[model samples]
Target: MTTINYISAVTQALEEEMERDEGVFVLGEDVGARGGVFRATEGLYERFGEERVLDTPLAESAIAGVGIGAAMYGMRPVAEMQFADFIFPAVNQIVSEAAKIRYRSNNDWEVPLTIRAPYGGGIHGALYHSQSVEAMFSSIPGLKVVIPSTPYDVKGLLKAAIRDNDPVLFFEHKKAYRLIKGEVPEGDDYTVPIGKADVKREGDDVTVITYGLCVHFALQAAEKLQEEGISTHILDLRTIYPMDRTGVVEAARRTGKVLLVTEDTKEGSVLNEAAAAIAEECLFDLDSPIERLAAPDVPAMPYAPPLEKTFMMNEDKVESAIRELAHF
Candidate 1:
């Protein structure tokens, strides 16, 4: 096993995939030379060369459209959005074309494209650079949304995303690039299957369900709460769209208490869908009402430090929520 940071795991996954498959290529703004806006693609250009590691114009739509076209022709294209906030321009291309290609074509075409974007807050990236975009695309039928919380899963899920025979939106928390690290198996084909929730920590008093950076925050909060006799069962919804209903239901049933945490706004967030599932499947088993702790319903995250802290959810907030829910 090798211990690596989140960003290095991303670089490792890209390098391994490109080396493993000849058809796998990467394209996005500043991906080739600049090594991605966050350096997630650093050193890949030098190793893979220009043809395989492409740097396209700053056009998100074109990036998705071109990747979709390549995927249709049997090439696996990984398209990167400089920031999750700037992915709006590519929504039409991703949602309409890449998502519906296989279904619309009646299984005649397969868009094996993976879109990678750094998401979530905590680095003071503020409104423009920091945002959780998984919620927007998670409800879309054909697009699989994945948000990995650890270095190990980052490598595995990304490889799985590239190999998937459909469009996948893989969101990495910029906050966790270096902050989160874990031991990953140092070998090939270390891919974690999508659509499954991971049990990060197991407890019986209350269940904290979340994804992305929130998973790390909740785990920290769980440790603090354990001293107070509140044992939290943490579930990381690694893939939001094709949610692990079985896992969500099982976790909810185990504790009889649920607290959904996320960095996105409370309204129409991923937790809302999760809350519905718990209510539908494990309503009778729940001891308390499903509670949620998330960012405020502001237009966007504020740039000011004070305002950003207020808008962002953290370990303290998670612990407080878990403590309260455990008492309920």
Candidate 2:
């Protein structure tokens, strides 16, 4: 096992996949020559050549549309949106065409396309650069959404998403792309199945369910809470769609308190689903009402660093909620 940064893990996955499969290709604005907006796809263009690693024009809609077409022809395409906020322009292709192709035509045609985007705020991305739109895609069926918090998960899940028959919206937290590090087994193509949650940290007092950048935050809060004698069970749901209800329920049952955390706005957020699941399935086991610590429903992230810090959820908020819920 070797430790690698999140961005390196992503690059490794793509490199491995491209080497393994002849039909797998990557296309996006600045992906080929510029090596992605965040350099996640850095060095791929030179290694894989222009045909396999393409750089398209500044049209997200056209990029997604071309990806869908390519996928229908049995070519797996990973299309990257420079930022998650910009994916809205390709919603028609993602929602109407890519997502529903297999189901709409009675399994005649399927899109094995993966839409990759860097999501979440915290690195001063401000309004347009930072947004967590997983819930929007979550509401729509037939689209698999993945938000990986760690380098290991990012590598495994990206490989899985590339091979999956359905269209997958893979959301990578930009903040986590460099912040988090973990050991990933070196080697050929390895894949972690979607719809499974990995136990990030095992404990008994409560379960902190989270993904993306906040998983690290939750782990940090759990560590601090441990010093205060609060044991937290952390569940990292690598894939949001086809959620690992079994894993979440088991954790909720073991630790009666559940804190759902995300960078997305709390109102109409994905946390609602996780909280409701606990309430519905493990209501009798829960010692307190389900609590959520998420980004406030602000239209845009503040430019000031201090204001941004207050706007986003962090370790202190999770710790406070954990203490309150544990004692409730």
Candidate 3:
């Protein structure tokens, strides 16, 4: 095992996949020369050359369109959207083409493509750069959505997504890219399957279900809760689309109480979906109403530190929710 950063894990996944499968390649803005805006693709251009690692125009639509067309031909393409917010321009291609191609055509053709992007608030990225758009794609039927909170999960889930025959939207929390570090299994063959929720921390008082940056936040809160004699279980929904509902239900049953947390706005958020699933599958086991702690529906992320802090969910908020649920 080797200790690596989240960005390094992602780069390793791409490089290994490219070596394993000739059809696996990367395309996006500044991917070939600049090695991506966040340097996630650094050193790739030199090894893979310009043909496999392409630098495209600034248009997201054009970049996504190319990936869709290539995937139709059975080539596994990983398209990088510079920022998660910028992916809006490619919504039609994602929802209408890449996502529905397999189902709409009755499995005759499948888009084995992965759309990679850095997301979430923090680092003072302001409104444009910091956004959690997972809910948008989670609502879609044909897309597989994944958000990894650690270097280990980032590497394993990315490889699994690449090998899968369906379209995947991979969200890399910008904050976790550098701040989070963990031991990733060595070698190129290691892979973690999609739709598995990891039990990040074990507890019996209450369960905190989340993904992305919130997973780390929930764990931090769980640590503090432990000190206060409130055992808080933390479940990281690593792959949100094909959600591990069974795992979530089991956690809830073990804890008897639930608190859902996420960086996205609470309204119609992915956490809400998880809570709803728990209610449907494990209502009899619930000791209290599932509490959801998330960002309020503000117009956009604020530039000021104080406002931005209030707009995002943190350890304090997560702990408060856990206390209420555990005592309810």
Candidate 4:
């Protein structure tokens, strides 16, 4: 076991996977020489050489297009988007082409590609740098959406994403890149299965379901509520698309109350989807109305630090919401 930050864990996963499989290569803006905008791909170019680690043009569409073409031709490509907000330009290739290739070809073709990007607010990235795009891509079929909150989960899930047979959109919270730290297994084969939710904190009073950086806030709130005799269960939905319905339903049923949280705007967010699922499956078990804590539906993130703070979900907000739901 090794204690590492989220960014190092991601770099380790890419290095190990590339070493294990010769076909696995990485490409993106400034990924080769600059080692990525956030250094998530640092030291990879020196280790794997220029051929395997490529620095593509600034165009997002071309990056997605090249990744899809390479994946269909038997190479595993890990394409990085400088920021999650910039991935919009590649939607045509990602949604219309890479996502539908397998079904369109009658299972004759599979796009074993992973699109990695840093997302979420809290670093004061503002506007174009701090947008959450999970819901946009998760709604599409033939795609897996993954957002890891900790170093361990990021490393393991990234490896799983690289080895999977389908296309995956992997979102890493920008704030968590260095802020979150944990012990990761010191091996190349360690992998966390996709579509499974891990209970970060076990409780009985309320179940707080969340993902990405919100998982850390939920855990913090859970810890504080414990001092007041309120047990809050926190479930981190690492993989958003193939959501762990059974785990979500079970947590809701076990606690008899639920509080869904997300950093994205509330409307049509992943929290809404989870709340709807729990409402349908565990309606009888619910003791209180499902509460969702998310950012307001606004045009874009504010550049001001104070306004950004109000726009993002934090431990204080999470704790207040949990207290309300626990009392309900």
Error of 4 at 24 (Å): 0.5
Indicate the TM-score of model 1.
Answer: 0.99
- Evaluated at residue 194, the lDDT of candidate 2 is 92
Candidate 3 ranges with C-alpha deviation above 4 Å: none
> Roughly what TM-score does model 2 have, to 2 decimal places?
0.98
Q: In candidate 3, how many Å is residue 112 off?
A: 0.3
Clashes of each: 0, 0, 0, 0
Clashing residue pairs in candidate 3, if any?
Answer: none
Query: Per-residue lDDT tens digits of candidate 1, residues 102-161?
Result: 889999999999999998887888778888888889788999999999999999999999
In angstroms, the error of model 4 at 28 is 0.3
List per-prediction Cα lDDT, in the order shown.
Answer: 0.93, 0.88, 0.90, 0.93
Per-model TM-score versus the true fold: 0.99, 0.98, 0.98, 0.99
> Which stretches in model 2 have alpha-carbon errors above 4 Å?
none
Candidate 4 C-alpha lDDT tens digits along 219-305? 988888899999999899999997899989998998889999999998989887788889899899989999989999997788899
In Å, residue 40's CA in model 4 sits off its true spot by 0.4
The residue-by-residue lDDT of candidate 3 on 75-157, one tens digit each, is 99999999999999999999999989988899899999999999999778899988999989998888999999889899999
